[model samples]
Target: MTAPTQERYRILALDDQRETVLSLQRALRPRGFDTEPYTDAARALDALASQPDSYDAALFDVVLPDVSGIDVLRRAKRIAPDLPVVMLTGDERAKTAVQALHAGAFGYLTKSTDDVDSIAHTLAQAARQRLLQRRAAQLERSLERVYGFEHMIGQSAAMRRVFDAVTKVAESDFGVLVRGESGTGKELVARAIHERSARASGPFVALNCAALPEALVDSELFGHERGAFTGAVGAREGAFERANGGTLFLDEIGDIPPAVQLRLLRVLQEREVVRVGGGAPRPVDVRVIAATHVDLERAVSDGRFRQDLYYRLNVVHIDLPPLRDRLDDVPLLVAHFVAKHADRSGHSPPTFSPAAIEALCSYDWPGNVRELENVVQRLLALVPGDEIRPEHLPSRVVGASSGRLRAVVVPEPQPVVDDLAWTDGMPFAEARRLVQERFERAYVTRLLDQVDGNIAEAARRAGMDRSNFRRVMIRAGVTADKPRRA
Candidate 1:
């Protein structure tokens, strides 16, 4: 393994006396300090002003030809107030030393004192103090990036609740259950929680329960002994073992087989795991965070999932609203994804035309945030121009507007026209009713198709709310599995 790099201290020495500055540099060099010696006080002040906090400390001579070292000390303090400045004087007058100390000097040293060891000790202490301050500032910036609300973009009330739940659970070690559609960013929320928790310094392990094979699911979660199975050539560790002292995020948890579910429950209940074909149970300290697009409660009620496991994992439930329910966040999500991909591909960031953004906002995203990200990446890769226009979007979006218009202008069949009484000056109410029914059918069908026929999400896009949307679906005779929404 490679050794870690040791931290180095940066020090600047300003004085008109070349001998004193050289001596200070030599003394600091032995202690692993990166030292810069300058005889001109004016030049040193200019450098400090250009990059405040550039050096951990500065040793200044009391006398200089052009500018007094005390003036340089005052100016350096103005640039970086916390920077340590030790004043050196040839005269040992108590009054001069007292004045230098009162003028914000970290220490006052007489050149004739010849105490190299004492000066080096004082500078080391100052360097440590400065290092602590820098570390504190860095930690604050990291915290802001991890927990800032801006990281999650959504203004809808449902999304607001999700934001609140994330904040509340971030401080706890209890298992979290994130339920949402496939594209709704459940993993992002899981990562955010792990980053904000006390275990941020530890590893974060993730596995997709639905993606793994049934036979391998158990060994994949709980490690196995050497020669446990044909493929188990050597002792191996699983996600739970790898995530010890940190967090293990189980994605699509509802799909885990019944046998795996029982084992998972044992781990959660006993805080220990027994590897496959292993003799004894090994204790594990891991925070559990599980997510699934399916409704675990409903699954349990229907006998498709274990009720005890559902309750164990559902200590903190965070339901992510689908993309359609939070249409207002499209522009923000689009901007973020564009910048992200642009950085990765080393391409200039692209701009979105108003019509393009409008098209995105108006259309229902069945796949949720994941679909939006894919669409954004696709537009960036395919659209050649600097600006993305409505025409640049995928065919599904461009066709939506035109198809709705055509459906309204032209009746589909003869029976439909006769029912509407196409004779000129037909009853106003009759025409209006016909138009309303046709528009609802077309609009609902289109939205359902956009989401790939997720009725719960289709209703959200239709703005009828989930339950009301289901009622309307019954009225319009729509089914879930038809791929009309996909």
Candidate 2:
């Protein structure tokens, strides 16, 4: 299929024999295919042009009622250049087979079910290939950019361990649990696993469990039927269903309530899910990769996390070393981030002076790679020269290099209203936003610490709904000191 809408692969079949069309549909449906057959070649061609993205591949009989299958193949290629079209015929003629292949037909198949089954085996792979080719062409035309590192850049011993674990885990279908501080790129690791797994051709669906409200976590994971809730206007597929034949990434897995955790465990156990409001249990073939910033071991002992669910999700555990623990990768990450943010804004990226890079490596990046990227972007925006020096670095970075500690995110030494430290050449609006964000992070973090990591109680103290407060916490990357028990 050139473009897969979701889970099912659609095929366009053109066969004058109505029964052959019907047989193809019935035969392929069980193998996760949807066949749209047209007896009239003209109508089939019309449909192909009208809805180009609906079909992943095409099947055409060598002889049509009104047109030669070879002619139809040529026209179909003109309509969708990347579509994989298979030719069908009982002809044993070598010339026709060669002609069809030279004409861009994906393969020549007999009308027998055996041939159909043979093509069926590679249908998914062809669809994925065609889709990727189309996407790469689009990117070349638009961005003039080729992908690099695939969202991960680390070469230290600790990170090498993570990469080793990822390579090993990607070879199987077992569930994985990635443990890391926020911004350490747990999602990146999850994505790498999906892209490297056998399910790479399928979807990669991710849901941030901490970002949603407690009232909606269940619905988001399991989906809901129309009229299931106040805002529910139509039936929907949950993460599990959406990720069928793929991998599902559940970030902040430790934040899910115990009840939802049990339901999740049930879904993993049964290999199917029943939507929240109403739906029959739909089978899903999804490999789950869960992640958490909090310490699940302590949570399990404290009764905040379910021990059984923990064991199930933790079939393999990968711990990402924090940024401070891997200073050797700083120069590499800094260079990459410089190019990345510079490319985004069409600026000629500058180089970091040795002292500047050293200062960056010395800082304890509490927010990890994400925080480093932010600092790098800020420097690019504020510093005007071709070279970034130590003075251009954040005071916290310089201070940390010289054995002084300050606030982690902002330039300010402390979270105080009266004291404000501004980055050189920062615009007033940019400065205001940085200050406000710092305040929000500090407020939520302090609030959580004061409440001993009790999120519900902290939300109450903030005078905000648990939903809104949780969103703030997520935006700030502040998890509870302790995971909340049910």
Candidate 3:
């Protein structure tokens, strides 16, 4: 396959001397750079103001009749902060170079010592730096879109419903309850709510109720006096006090002990919290966003969770769908995880083969997105091949294919009741081939039937490339029988 070509970097050259401009144009054009030369510095400055993004780098001559290159650099910076500027000067004064550097010039080249090679080399470096800067900026913006207000990445209808609910609840001051299976990003949803709310500027505090000991839950939620408990060395502020005028995310809220639950409910209702072992109640203006993987209703019914607390937190609810239900998003999620981990480790992520992707999509992700990310990290770390095949996947992921395709997999054909009469009469090889043919036919029939005669899903479930699977179907004489998707 042909590799994709990169866009050529454009250079804006501003020099009063036409000869000097010609020299630069000749030097750079051979190196595959597009040079836009200007004899008037004023015109160049105007272009910079109007079309700052059109050029990747600028080369400015120090002395111009209309305006000094330094002035142009300052103005250009104000208009486009990221544009790389390289100063060109006939004067070899060290102070001039110093001044250019102070004005944010990426490079300083003197016309006397500046041969075609040197000028090209310096400008090339500057252009490359510009490209890097642009890429870094693009990455930052991409990350913002991925991890911003709608940070939970999903295009599925189920996730769209969650996003809609979050947007509506964010404008209100009602307590929010985020419910999902573990590793489904309950905390991300909670953070999205807080960031979208009026309290976005306020501190966002998080406390995992299940992570703390029963003895420390109360002290952690509502601060404690210096002598409130044995480990209470100082007058410490809790999540509630610290998150005043902001948000406090209480994760695993259902796991909190009953005593702490009561205190949490009171704080939610009254908008105040009395520190542990303290008599006075202090007013706290905090929004609480609670998350839990367990069903709070079931916990409440079982007397393990408090009903009032559940109701308080459930005023605004967002139920995140598990990864298996939104399998259509698996590819997108996989690519995202690969890029994320690759960036962290400073390595290129391996590409997944059709069979490898099929293996991933076929498996039911019990641990959800978190597990998928972990697997991607593992693949990047361990897989030496550029392309990841089915063999590169974890055994569990590949093994899941059988379980998922079990309904369509052909089982061994049973013998007629009380007999091996046919086998007794036939040759061993012939009988085995006959049984295999029957199994193939049955497997194809069951697969096509399960997918409503759609060959695509059947092929996918079989963990074969589409074209290869089609060949298998043809060889098995099943292609003509299965209907194509409309």
Query: Among these predicted structures, which one has the highest TM-score?
Result: 3
RMSD of each: 21.1, 23.1, 15.1
- When summed lDDT is taken over every stretch of 10 residues in candidate 2, the lowest stretch is 404-413
Which stretches of candidate 2 lie above 4 Å from their native place? 1-149, 403-486
Clashing residue pairs in candidate 1, if any? Answer: 366-451, 448-485, 449-484, 449-485, 452-485, 452-486, 453-485
Which tens-of-lDDT digit does each residue in 1-486 have in candidate 3? Answer: 111135466889999999889777876776767889999877887888889888888999999996889988888888888788999988899999999999999899888634767776677666666665555455445444543246566666787788888899999999888989999999888888888999999999999998998988888899999888787788888899999999999999888888788888899889999999886999999999999998889998999988888888888788899998877567657656665555444334567764566678778999999999899888888888678888989999999964343212222234423344545677889767766655666677677778876677888998877787766654443432233334
For candidate 2, give the lDDT of residue 469: 93
Q: Which has the greatest lDDT?
A: 2
Overall local distance difference test of candidate 2? 0.80
In model 2, state the lDDT of residue 326. 83
Model 1 compared with the native: what TM-score? 0.54
- Which lDDT values do the candidates have, in the order given? 0.75, 0.80, 0.77
